[model samples]
Target chain A: MMKDEELVIEARDLTKVFLDFWGRPKVRAVNGIHLDVRRGEIFGLLGPNGSGKSTTIKMILGLLHPTSGQLSVLGQSPRAVSVKSRMGFMPEESYLYKYLTADEILNFYANLYGMTGSAKTERVNALIEQVGLSQARDRRVGEFSKGMARRIGLAQALLNDPDLILLDEPTSGLDPIACREVKDLLLALARQGKTILICSHHLADMQDICSRVAILLQGEVCATGSVQELLSTPDTLKLTLQAPSQTTLMAVLDLLERETGTRPQVDLTGRTLESVYIETVSKRKSAS
Target chain B: MSHYFGKSLTRISALAGLTVRDAARSRLLVSLGGILIIGLIGLPLLISGDNTLTRRLQVILNYTLSFAVTMLSIVTLWTACGGVSSEIQDRRLYLVLTKPVHRYELWLGKWLGIVALNALLLTLTGFIIGIMIWHTLFTSPESETGKRQACEQFLLARQSRLPESPISEKQAQASAAALVKSGRAPAGIDAAQVATELMKELKNARFVIAPTGTVHFTTLITTPLSGINDGLLNYKIESSRPERSPIPALWEIQAAGKKAIHLSVTNYPGLPNRLLIPGAVMKNAPSLTLSYHRLDSSSSATLFMAQNGQEPELLIPSGSWAMNLGRGLLMILCRLAFLSALGLTAGCLLSTPVAVFAAFFIMVLLAMSGYVESVATSGAFYIPHEGHELSKTWLDKVILSQFKGLNRLTQPLLRLDPVPLLEEGRRISWLLTTQAVAWLVGLYTAVTALIGMILFNRRELG
Candidate 1:
């Protein structure tokens, strides 16, 4: 477990109230929320529609001003330009310059961060290749497919190699293969000691990746805990074993049923379909 | 300071490059260029010069060039407006602002990109017109004499010298006092009204010549007239006699410390006539003195040489035509830069269509700035008929007064206009170009960029 002292993000009573045209109170998008994200942690913000997940993420990214609260990323105000340089944000949509090619889009962002010369070109090419868009690098973004555009967006978010990467619905339009790639990429980045804040509704995906999470409801945190603490069934015992003979499995189930005075539910033990699919496709790719 | 500037410059350069790429790829740019090319090249094919190749060239330069400038300005404003407004609307601005770019950098970068594009387009069209004009001049069937005359008078940048400055307020006041004392003005007449009336009258007043008498006037020559002989003197002669007829006269021109020129005026109709003087006698003269003798002893006459009123002028070559054209275009570019800044500021504050409409509205107002000036200075919206005073209502007074204030605010921005000078083949003086650069491109652009940056920085992007 990472130490709690190295906090990369801190919020105290953080709130954001969206106003009407007249600037009167219209809706409370985030209400008095507190959060602490440590360095090298994969933190997830999970919620349903209108539950303030995206709004909270936007506030954290300094896109929206809080009504009343203190929020900081990298020990500085989110609005700080230098702080922004060290951070990256992938918004809910792929808001890229449609007229520019993928290569240009990455290069543009890199240059905005004051990167230039061969270093910029090399980084841009590497990003394009990493996002698996090397083939379509020259195609205009407007001509790219939704999945391809999402991939490019991810690549741009990583262009500066930011320490604090914020991804909002990062896997929304990605294919399963791309989704796995993104999840693995997040893990790899976390291993490299980068702080990641992901706002999404994919519970299974979040469970597979997030070390800690906060569930929001009606602009408030309904629950907050580590993945194990939140999802683990303390009252139940689980066993994982290789598939045995049918008789052996039946005897084990009978013993459990007799002890509990109830029927035991049995299920097949196998790899997840996603894992199997990835394995099959990768094997085929390697053979080709 | 240098380090920060260098960093800001780098970011601004990147954003400007991106903006240029976007503009180049836009279909609107291509469409505008197509229209501009058609208007520039195709219009000459459609219009006949009426007779003379000089007239044809004049029409092309006057109409086609003006049309091209207007079109380019409109397109430049449109591109500038769309460059910022469309980015905000499409949410692409979100991506950009999230980077480490300052709002000022973004604003300046957009302006620079639009300006760069305008320069390219203007240079291209200007080159085409220049080439076309030279080709037409070389290929025309006019004799060498006609060609040389046209080249000397129409194709060169000339400076105009008047007899004197216009009648000042003090002169007008003196005239008003004479009129009041002479019992011409009614008792208790409005003194301000009388002064204005006298000013207008003095502006159009004629120089009177008694029968068989001589009238002398001296003019300070500012430009050099060193070439072969030719001068145009515009005059209107009116005879005070029972039988209306042309008056004959002897024209004597005495240059400072030079041999005097004597020519006989044979025809002087009631309508204005242009007298062509022979010999380059006015050359190397610091000033010129004209003596008009009324040789027609039977009739008295009046001569009019009003300033800017079809007055007699001595046009002297001052500079090269090509350099003058370049200066004129540079002035146009300055105005375009100001317009681009205004469009960008509006775009930052409003949506695309609204910003475009506002910019166009401002352009129209600037084009009609003469009316603004009149209303502001005279407190009258429109000039009255000859010898009549305007009856202004309170509403007219209030509205015109307000417009007067606005005119005072925007006068500096609207003052320099190069089109007329270009049409007349007059030198666009360096002073005027300097004023344009100072106000239009420097002060005005900076203010506009500041306002845009403030608005954009305060804007909430989602």
Candidate 2:
């Protein structure tokens, strides 16, 4: 485990209970879940629907207070204004002011961080370009397509160049190419020693970028470890090679069965569908 | 500390700017602006006044200015209510709350935004009305006297000074006691109520002058009327007999140690008349006593003066019409500021429709506060029939108490109304404007804003 100083987010028995109007507890959205997100790591929170992923993220962002437990972000209370200054959050939906242009939205958030002058402009401009929204920066967000709005949301999240970023379903409505781009961006941010916490249902994307992951079930963490430690199969072995003739493949299978006294499963390696779709689109765009 | 405050100000200003931009781009404001322009131009053309230019100008000013203020007030309340509630309903507030901005800052920013929008719209309306008044006054084919009368009576900012009451409360109370002892007072009403009613009747009786009898009135001018060329004494007389034609009267006016100036004049009942006092007679004279003597001894008709204390006013030109109009607009702005704060507080506590409804309900309640006060003061829940009485229940008492509280809370809002003053060409004084700011904006608005900020901060935005 990393030392406490290097921990960006630390939680002990963190819990949140939603209450009805009369103050009776209605739902235990997050129950006694512990988390430690260290510096310079991509941490994934994996869960099904209603598994408390969004609830946990909201608590961490100080949008909702925890019913009981202890939580600290960057060695300060989650609600500390100074701490929020160093953190960025992207909610499940875009949730942007529909009347404001993409550029105006970014500028508004930048101002909240007390940024001004050329530095703010440069940072906003760069984030717009990075999120692939430069073409639509002047258009109102209400007029944008879902994918375009998602891109602008991401740009706003990066406006202040926050040290710790929390994203809930970051690529929820993106196309395959944009999804890949987002994953690539997460990896790049992780390499730059920035801590990132992502809550998502996209397991393939999570597997591609997350160094460590915690799986939640019914507001409880059921499993947590490094990706390799949690997913590896010690007794299973497989080999990948270039395509062989039918006769050669049969001979190899017979030899392996005779030696091990067991029949082995055979499968061919293939590229993910996401990769295939992205490649096709990229090729078409370049040709055009 | 200053740096920190400066940063906070920047954040708040940015939020306010965004709010204004949002409203500017919305269809609601655009539609309202179009409607306002149409009303300003069309309402005057639709309502043709009497052929006199002064009456025409008065009609235009009264209707157009009132329409503008009413429309703007409604818009202000609607926009402020929706600005916060809809953002929360749509989850757009999530993005803002998660930032470094405090919730109070957000609330204040929205309020300031609404107030600024109202200011802009009100300025536009005032400018258009001003142009119309100027054009009508300067270019119309009306006679010079007609135009001059319009300027003096309906355009200049004049302060009114009323005559002191001739009867005193002590004397009225003593007379009421004597009447009660003699069994001449009404039996059902309380003694205090009887004394109050008797005071009003006795004061009215003091204004009646019998045949050949003289009545005197003293007026004290607090401010020195050095530069003013003339002042006007406006009076309206009522008679016991409505059919009586022109009654001759003599007026004697005397100043401290100066020769009495006497004039013979004819008075018509139920008609308003003004006598101009020359600057020379008013120069350096702080006090004047006027004696009215009835010259018609053959007729038994008695002249009656109104007891409302509005008549027999001495009008002194205080300031220009433009300045008065500006002050009137400022008063309206103060009212809008209070409404903005009220709507914001409601929005913080309730949903959009509920907030809007609650705000409007409060406004309606304020409009009917006079009635509420009367009912509360009456101390009865239901009106009793003739010769019937109903005892009070606990619920009735509770409701009456609530109404009393509401009256007390809303009294400040209804204290200074600018529309009537502006229509009548009376001065909306700087002192009155300051009091409005104190009560409407300073006290009422600040209280609502504090409540809103507290609720908003405690609320969970997720």
Candidate 3:
């Protein structure tokens, strides 16, 4: 009896301090963090590098124990293996056993979670096809490029069809196309009612699919809310109108300024590089 | 709930599966296996005492097995190191660490994996040697051939012969008991002495002991003594196998006090003076005694005499006395366990291999230091002045000082100079048992626990 919108994660004053070999303090990697995520939501933890977003995610997953404080997932301790049996993880880096074939790596992980026999085979095969890595699944993980590795990592992370999934920098090293494919995959998983916690520095990507976002800075949550809420402020409006020549835009901005009082600026007078690039690529695809 | 998890068995089995596969694929392990077979098989064929094959088997038991343990333990370092360190290096540590698994499970799994791997390799190697030995026993190689010279002539000669099965069990037991009660054993109240006295009591017994060095030359090893001449069987140089021609003794009928002792070291001789130890003298040498005065680095000696004929080296009389193989095996396993324990502990605490290796080196040094305090302790090598009786505490400290243990066959195996246990093996299995327990349950266990704790505390996923 799984509850929809039930709290899947809860952290109370979670703190993690990294220590040196001699047990001396080195860094307070994460500090006094409090967070909760409703079940079946794509929760995004956004931050720059070393911002403790990944640390927080790991704590939620029980890959790391918090130095102080407590955390639970699905009403159970993160470290409970039984709970882990219902969880999947995608680390920031695909630190997979290189010597193992992708198939072997998947099987090893499946076995770790106690998935076995036909169920394991069926799940691994489906996930491989789903992640679009069916062709390369037999290859040694060592032979994989970073992008390919990330694809396999995603596939393995989904093997258990876990109730809670944690993805750290899931699309960090993928090509744009691959990134789009992964984004679509996350959305599809979300649509299927899987809860996901993703940690990423790519704020744009986070903003796109996340049900809610937690923006972190220096081991603390700076802001947390839905993407639209965080993006909207009384002071700024991101207006997108039909593109114009610089002269026409300037005139329009002057008129708008006269009406609105505060300075209005003519921005991106013509299609920006990203827009142009996307358009060109789409046009090529259509022509093909 | 963490206790009695069925996962320990499951994890160990999975890890063992991987471990066996890995070792089987290793070229070094395979080659090492092949060489060990050749050595074990070829060695027995090369040497045969006219009277006892048991003595020949003794050589293999004492020396070859020690070497095996050393090689196996060294192999454990790489296996154990790769078990975790390589995973971390390749960034694959995250896979297991993040699996909602207990940290201790991973550590324990890895240890079990490596040990299972080592045991497989060593046990297989041991099996091959065992089979060869089994073959050697069922069919004694031309035992009816050695020229039977007159007994009195052989007895008077300066010989270095492997022991023959002349002494009976009763004689060996009597002698071993006599040796212990008389305190004639190298160290007082030593297990070896008791065993040796018992062995001496066994006047007419035939048994094969493991590898031991013997010197039956009729002469006091040191000090000016009498009537020694050439024409006698002064020296018989043999490789690990039987030889057609005897190698000449390095020392002939030499002068007195100047000291002329033939020394051919198969491995570095144990801690003591270099002397002519023949194939017989070491034959069933009473479990060797490791005598080290704590805090004292002064040299010590072990004098083993494998009598020329009818002097049963070991008291035991088995119908099919192959050799003392299982005797030191427990000790060997214990030593390996300790080495791995130390290595694993260091590996956990320090991410750096150099740091870990350094830590391992320190552990070995400490164990060896059990012999005597290092000169690094203080400038005190020789004995104190006669009238100056040192205090109990200082003496204890000095006695417990660090030392570089004797690494005869391999490096200081026990690190704690486990000679006393060997010396007392016959009468007192306790010393050896104690050392084994200390190794298995003490250093190795403690270090393994430490390793587990460190690993459990580590944060890898982040």
CAPRI classification of candidate 2: medium
- For candidate 1, what is the TM-score? 0.88
Query: In CAPRI terms, where does candidate 3 land?
Result: acceptable
lDDT at B362, model 2: 90
lDDT string for model 2 (A40-106, tens) is: 8999999898998888888889888989999999889888888888888888787998888999889
lDDT of 3 by residue, A1-288 (tens): 777868889888889998887999899988888888888799998888889887787777676789998888889988776787778888878777666778877877776666657998998888888777888888988899998899889888888788888998898888776787799889988888889999887877888889998888889888888888877898777788778787998788888889899777545556556556767887998999
lDDT of 1 by residue, B284-306 (tens): 77778877777777554544433
Task: Write down the worst ten-residue block by lDDT for model 1 chain A.
Answer: A1-10
In model 3, what is the error at residue B73, expressed in angstroms? 1.2
| Residue runs of model 1 more than 4 Å from their true location after superposition | A1-4, A243-262, B165-216, B228-254, B257-279, B290-311, B382-397
DockQ of 2: 0.76
Q: What lDDT tens digits, residue by residue, belong to model 3 across residues B169-230?
A: 66656766776677676774565556655555442122212133223222222211122211
Q: DockQ for each of the predicted structures, in order? A: 0.66, 0.76, 0.38
lDDT of 2 by residue, B1-462 (tens): 988898798888988888788878876667777888899877877785664676668777899989998888888888889888989999898888888888888998898888888888888888888888887788778889668766766677878877766657787678778888888888876667778998777667767889888888888877766744556678778888869588888878777777888778898888887776655666678877888888999888878765565467777777888999999999999999999998999998889999999999998898787788778788745755577677666777788889999989877777777888888677888999999988888999999999999988888766
Most TM-score-accurate candidate: 2
10 residues in a row with least lDDT, candidate 1 chain B: B299-308
